[model samples]
Target chain A: MKALEQKILTDGIVLSDTILKVDTFLNHQMDPLLMKQIGEEFAARFQHKEITKVLTIESSGIAPAIMAALQLEVPMIFARKRKSLTLQDGLLTSNVYSFTKQEETEISVAKKFLTEDDHILIIDDFLANGQAALGLLHIVEQAGATAAGIGIVIEKAFQDGGERLRERGIQVESLARIESLQDGKVQFVKETRRVEV
Target chain B: MKALEQKILTDGIVLSDTILKVDTFLNHQMDPLLMKQIGEEFAARFQHKEITKVLTIESSGIAPAIMAALQLEVPMIFARKRKSLTLQDGLLTSNVYSFTKQEETEISVAKKFLTEDDHILIIDDFLANGQAALGLLHIVEQAGATAAGIGIVIEKAFQDGGERLRERGIQVESLARIESLQDGKVQFVKETRRVEV
Candidate 1:
């Protein structure tokens, strides 16, 4: 977690008050070494839970989710944004609104991949409005699977998404929580309340 | 490779004459252990190359790319289909046509991540029409980067993509090359001729 927080401080750029671009190390251009550390942290944090599968949306979440799955010794399921020719007719579909793209797109997972007996841990790169996480949660619910927990690389704490999930009593763990980005400076929540692992 | 072949024979579904769905372990719901095996195989094959970075498109490609990067101990850069709010402005963009989706989509990578000094290895989940690989190659060219090789999990031998890239003298290493999918039987190319490693 410290390594990730350090990497974000060194390489991450604040594009605006609302957008934090960690593309140099996190999403677009990934640092596999740092990713491994983040994966280990997530594994340590969620070690007690029964994680049958690691669920994530495509593009950004694949790297960390795959790393976590490897550490957790579980399989990873990535929800496809668009339906491909190879995908079968039976699928678990959910519509998710992208806060950035300003579009509502249907994210889907093949029906056979997820079952009611599975316990899923959702992972993603960024948690801003939490639409992506919510969509993945919806997919898990549709499959009658248990949502073990949610792991995030970075969370925009100023946003209501994280708070909203917490209000629902869902266990969420993030490596770095940014309280705010004021004048190109990132503020983190003080270690006043310890996160129960 | 044997493990991968076995997985394909067992879990891979032949949806139709041209489609082979291995979503249970490859793309949608990924088996991390198998994915690690795939990464090790790719690393062993391309170990001699001076791979400074691993390049891939987002979604399906991210898992294998990350695994390959971890094995290779190099940075991994994934081109995003849609630029999210967190993505930087200056990016090397290319148009990729998806045969499955029957549409053309724009993919981009941040310009800062890749450079002329970097030697890249492009990895992908599938190589059908090679539009995605071609698009990635275009981005590498835009960055003036040298493409060391191209690695694919599965290559449809009937498709012209692999043939076209090989015609241009690009080193393409496909783990499993399906010659044909006739009558729900997946046939791989005979290992008589040595495939370029």
Candidate 2:
């Protein structure tokens, strides 16, 4: 976790007061060693939940989520994002709104992958406004599965997404929690509090 | 590699004569153990290339590519796909046509991540028409980098993609080479040949 926070500070770019770009390492171009470490941290944190599946959105979340799934010795399922509303049967679908792109995209997973007997662990790269996490949670509910916990690589704590999930009694664990990106300076949360679900 | 071949025969669904759906273990719902094995296999095959980086497209390719990168102890960069032509500066972009989806999408990588000194290993889940690999090779060329080789999880040898790449003297190592999908049965290539590039 410290390595991730340090990497974020050293390589992450702060474009504005609210926007942080981690294309150098985390999302676009990835450091596999760091991703492996992240996976280990997530696995160690939520090892008690008895997670059966690791769920994440496609593209950005695949690297970290897959690594975590490998560490957890479970399967990783990534929800495919579709711009057009081509709804298909036997698929669990949810719409997620991206604040940066300012567009609504539908994320879907096959129904056969999830069942009531499964325990799901949701993972993502960034937890801003919690739209993606919420959408995944909705799909998990649709499958009649149990939500074990949510693991995030980076959380914009200044935003209300983390708070919202915690309000719903969800265990949200983030490696690096950004308190603020004000004035082009990166500020991290001084302390992390765990919410027992 | 034998494990991968067995998995395909057991779980891979032949949706049609031209399409094989591997969502059960390769793409949508991923088996991390198999993915790790795949990573080890790719790393072993391309280990002599002195690969400085591992590259792939977004979503499906991320899992295997990152695993290979981890095994190789290098960085992994996934090209971002864009439907709209944003045309951002400081980015290497290439257009890839998806035969399955019947659409053309632009895949972009940050120019800073790739350099002339880097030896890249391109990894992907499938090598069908090789449009994605071609696009990635173009990006690597634009960056003045050397493409050591390509590691494909499954190669549709019946298609011209693998042939086209091999014709150009590119080293393409595919774990499973499917010769045909006739009558909903998967037929693998009788013998595998290594093209010395």
Query: Which regions of candidate 1 are displaced past 4 Å?
Result: A192-197, B86-88
Q: In model 2, state the lDDT of residue A98.
A: 88
**Whose DockQ is greatest here?**
1
Q: Model 2: how far is B115 from its true place, Å? A: 0.9
> In model 2, where do residues sit more than 4 Å from their true spots?
A83-88, A192-197, B83-87, B192-197
Q: What is the lDDT of candidate 1?
A: 0.87
Give the true-structure RMSD of model 1.
Answer: 1.9
Highest TM-score against the true fold, candidate: 2
What's the distance in Å from true for residue A61, model 1?
A: 0.9
- DockQ of candidate 1 (2 decimals): 0.78
* lDDT by residue for model 2 (A1-197), tens: 78998998999888888888898788888999999999999999989999999999998899999999999999999999963222255799999998877899989998999999999999999998999999999999999999989999999999999999888887899999999999888999987645455
In terms of docking quality, model 2 is medium
Supply the TM-score for candidate 2.
Answer: 0.96
Q: What is candidate 1's lDDT per residue for B12-90, written digit by digit as tens? A: 9898878888888888889988888888888888899989999998788888888899999999998988677656488
Q: Which ten residues in a row have the lowest lDDT in candidate 1 chain B?
A: B188-197
